[model samples]
Target: MRSAAADRGAVHRPPCRADAGPDDLETDVEEIQNSVYWHDTEPVEVGEPLDGDASCDICIVGGGYTGLWAAHFLAEAEPSARIRVLESHTVGSGASTANGGFVGLTAGKVLRRLLWYYGREKAAGVYRTGARSIIDIGRFCRRYDIDADFAMNGMLQVVTDRKQLARLELQVKRSERTGLRGSFKLMGRDEAQERIGSPQVLGALRTTGALVNPHRLVQGLARVVRGQGVDIHEHTPAVDVRRVGNGYRVSTPTGTVTANEVVLATNAWQHSFGQTHTKVMPVWNYLMVTEPLTDAQLDRVNWPGREGVSNSLSFAHAARLTSDNRVVWSGGRWYYFDGRDTGRGHIRNAAAFRDLRESFARFFPAWDDVRFSHAFGGPIGWSRTFIPQFGRLADGVVYGHGYTGNGLAPSHTGGKILRDLVLRRETEYTELAFVTVNQPTFAKGAIGDTGAHLFVWRQETGDRLPLMLPHQAALAPRAFFAGRAARKARAADTGR
Candidate 1:
């Protein structure tokens, strides 16, 4: 078995970068870490990891949704399986706790392109799974009686410019062809304003997405998983993982656990480990919440609806109201995403704190001067492909990461699928286009970062172009072509 000390040396060599900043991790847990939707829930208490050599049929390296779900499933799959979870920190401390509490079945770049390049049947399967994922999540929450403010008022893919209208229309057409089960519509600026309470909208595609209490969900899952008799340990970092005999041995600071199967759900932190760090470049994002606006304020704008809205910009803008009368809206990323929170509470920039306020007024003029109660910012993890990943490594070891900043419902879905993959169980959802199990690998150097940043930046910028350029539609395939050449040449240059 790999010793804990040896594993630590293999991965992160301290001082572990004193530069690890709050931009990478949000600051002050006293502030609003998650939105007001989860304001009422209690926090989960910390637990200890195994202190002696132990054995389990399955051992999960993360305590987030993925690990919790794995434990939940293992209890059923092999009731006798000695299942244990070793978290680097408290359960849900990673992206599971840090995510902006937005959960929908929206798939990203590859999925969208697959529809355009591969046609409907394949794409339909992907879309159908996404639609069903929403149902699956709801079922889990209901079955477990998880109170994460799991609301299904739906999501609005709103647009702010006429040029983007064509792109949105194309997506609408693709949605129709896929025969995905959900109601979707094209709302013009005026119609959208009526529903969104934002006049800045030029168009919108409103569908059944959801607004959630992310931390609450995380805590709830952790609770129920423990209740199911899963052995969970917090503040227990998996210092090393190596194949041992037919299974794996996970070494922590205080002890070790040998298991038949191991799962890693550490997200961007996985990069600290030799392989995943380079493949999954860490990115940062910022979010702000307003003090509860009065019911009188909400009624004037006609935005009392429980729905949530996201714009078509490259960097998305999402807004939803809290039961407490606050509206949490967000947009933009950090300038240098070395996983730092360089831009927090610099109210002077206004981009982070004020942009959403502007959006609220443009969409719903009734919410003026409703001051921001709090602002919290943190790093969000993404993979090179911009698709969330799921796979096994070194025989019985498996892990999932790269939610690309969208990890609400997907977390639940990923956990269920991941557990099934670990146990080799037959699940009806297994037929979905799950993320490929390519082992942890990195893109070539600054070339990789440059290419990634460019595409992300380009998409981020172009998404807003439709708002500014009324006559020309934004194109993704063209962006792909441009990025493909640069990425390949750069990859070769760096030997990636």
Candidate 2:
């Protein structure tokens, strides 16, 4: 599963001077490879593209984690059913391989909003389901012998400033009050420093989480799906999807796939389809991976557990160590292009790379001498509610998108929900909090683009000037109610 192409022909350069300011490091982006580090770790053997029209019992678009997981689950549940997955690019080349690989609760970040809108019981149910999904993914990897470097190391939600500490403490309290007493452990400055060794971290909330080589996990899952008699056609994009005689016909560049049931598993690209165009906004996020740390450099930090760490800001920064010991840092301000553009032309944002490098150095001064070997960006499908949505478009079509940049574990949960929907079964997955007939959507056209920019500005401003502004929690109610109003408006128009 290794190839010479994995090298990417990247030329390493000398590390930026430790004394160099953030502005000085911005010009050093050329030293990094404009590629995904995870993808370069292994070779992906793409399946042949479809040369002719095809028909199957189930047709799945987008061969990322969600689509592959759905195929794997459906094949096991209905061994004789025909399943086909259509991928626009090579499998797992989308956000699945572009993320920081911090597998944690999907709704954990929005727990307060969930409690405000969906009651404590339902919020807890979503949180519990997320916790179980993490374990289930580990089991799935072992069951299929997929060596994805899965580790159940907990995650740290550390606060970098005093203003953020109170919000972190509130989250811990809410978790306990929601019947998850032992799920989150609040750590003071000393305890938090022991795990992260960052002077800026005043406190943290350590919670159940895991890490994985997302590329390996997704590629191995695709292999398992293929072994189970599921057809995966790579480099085959779904051009359009239309209804046809109680089924759906998905048009592709190579051919067409008419199936009795269709699963729209394309996350960020879901906006390209009319059925889901307004349902999600594709926002670009960037990441930079440092060259492997030397033993001496590793000793400079006290992170023996190698836990994934993230800050408490609205546009937070997250850092995690890869299996090979490289630090992958991500998260800053997210960008939304006009006209909902998600093309590859936007993958190399100089500003985002600069922000990531600066933040990484600030978080771990010990790594200031380490140079980045890779830098890249990808779009994440964001729903207005900051959670995933699962439901049927028509009797013959179903979709599971809107993970809101936290899809690794929840996509597994989404697979089960899609499975039950495709099989027409009333199971627990279909009854979860995110599974609804209608979810909130973003505004369309120029207004939508303006709103997206305004949201990003607010997040960045809050993180930049925490003391000068109110806590993000204070603004949560207004955002939540705005989403509620949008949902009601959508429901009214659709008469659902």
Candidate 3:
């Protein structure tokens, strides 16, 4: 499922560095803190941890969006089915609450790859399904009165260099050739700045998507599930899961649960299962939020449409305006611990946040004076093929994960797929390409670590390669310096 075209690299111009004083780049705002900003305004009541032994018709291992959505749809379809969700932490404590909250398509070269693999029609069908998921999520929020601060403001994939324009053009042509004409439109410098006033943005591709308060969305789903008689237990990690005489037994520290069916919705933590070790790798990403902007300050930018903006580079920088007018900025630096470890210690990377803060300054020079109110992050599941994995495992153990960094909308679609699988029904969702694909896994031990490192290096290098060889020749020295910085950053990531 690897993309030779994508691997060959896209030519993009080198990004221009913004001129700023040392003070401007590194603010004296002592209030810079660490917390999930989305949860600060919307606090959710945490459910009690799993108690002593229990049994149900179905037991879900994770209480995040994937599990909650599965519970929601399955409960709606089968009212009498007993469902229980077990969480190691709170419902929204994982990537559900900590992500950038962009409910966009997972068509990051997916359409192109699918076209090469399955041709235009099947690729179009899968791409359309992914797009529909975003719209359906908005409808779900409205019908249930779940105020997740969801806004259908679309998204912008902007490019700062001329080399990057070629990449955007390729994407646009692929979209048009695959019957997604109006869905993706290329915007020049002037048109892009009109949507978001940023000096670094030279061009952009506009696409439909929604921004959400991920914390509120997940909490609202949990409440709805609980109201529908679904038992959800927090702090109840599944220590072991094995097949019983006719069903499965899930053992926890406090007790055990026996169920006719089991679901492993744990994303990054799927390492608990030996089968998922190479199927997914947990990568840490950081995010930061600025204090609320004054009305006068907000007037400086012409982002009245409030579109979620991200650069076209790999491991791109992303930004969106919150309900309170604060800026949620993320990306630029990502970390992968040895042996694919995932825990609380991996959440705080001061160097990563520092790099993000500097990027924020470069993107929005006018906001240099604004101080960040919160900075926090968590791990996301990354598969070798860069596509999410969804299918049934042995012993009636169903699962959906490996969303890489894009899971918000896809999780909803995944819920539908899991529901069909649970009922043993052959529906449209169950027939999608994502459900029937054979995804490869990474190697074990040092080879695996080196492979992951090389992947990151390729993405960074491919992103920096200028389309014209002359430009690449001119920036050869700069590339050497960039490589050194990347090595130093990786060495500093002790995952302590």
Cα deviation of 228, candidate 2, in Å: 0.5
Tens digits of per-residue lDDT, candidate 1, 290-340, equal 555665666766454667878765577778875555677666644334332
Which candidate, 1 or 3, has the higher lDDT?
Answer: 3
Q: Write the per-residue lDDT of candidate 3 for residues 184-223, one digit (tens) a residue.
A: 6556677789999999887777898999999889998899
Give Cα-based local distance difference scores for all models.
Answer: 0.63, 0.84, 0.79
Q: TM-score of predicted model 3?
A: 0.88
The parts of candidate 3 lying over 4 Å away from their true place are 1-31, 468-496
TM-score of each: 0.79, 0.91, 0.88
| Best-fitting candidate, scored by lDDT | 2
lDDT of 3 at 446: 84
Candidate 2, 293-372: lDDT as tens digits: 78888899889889999988878889899887888889888998999999997778888988787787788887767767
Residue 489 miss distance in model 2 (angstroms): 48
Error of 3 at 59 (Å): 0.9
lDDT at position 393, candidate 1? 56
Better of 2 and 3 by TM-score: 2
Write out the backbone clash pairs for model 3. Answer: 12-163, 12-164, 13-163
Native-referenced Cα lDDT, model 3 = 0.79
TM-score of 1: 0.79
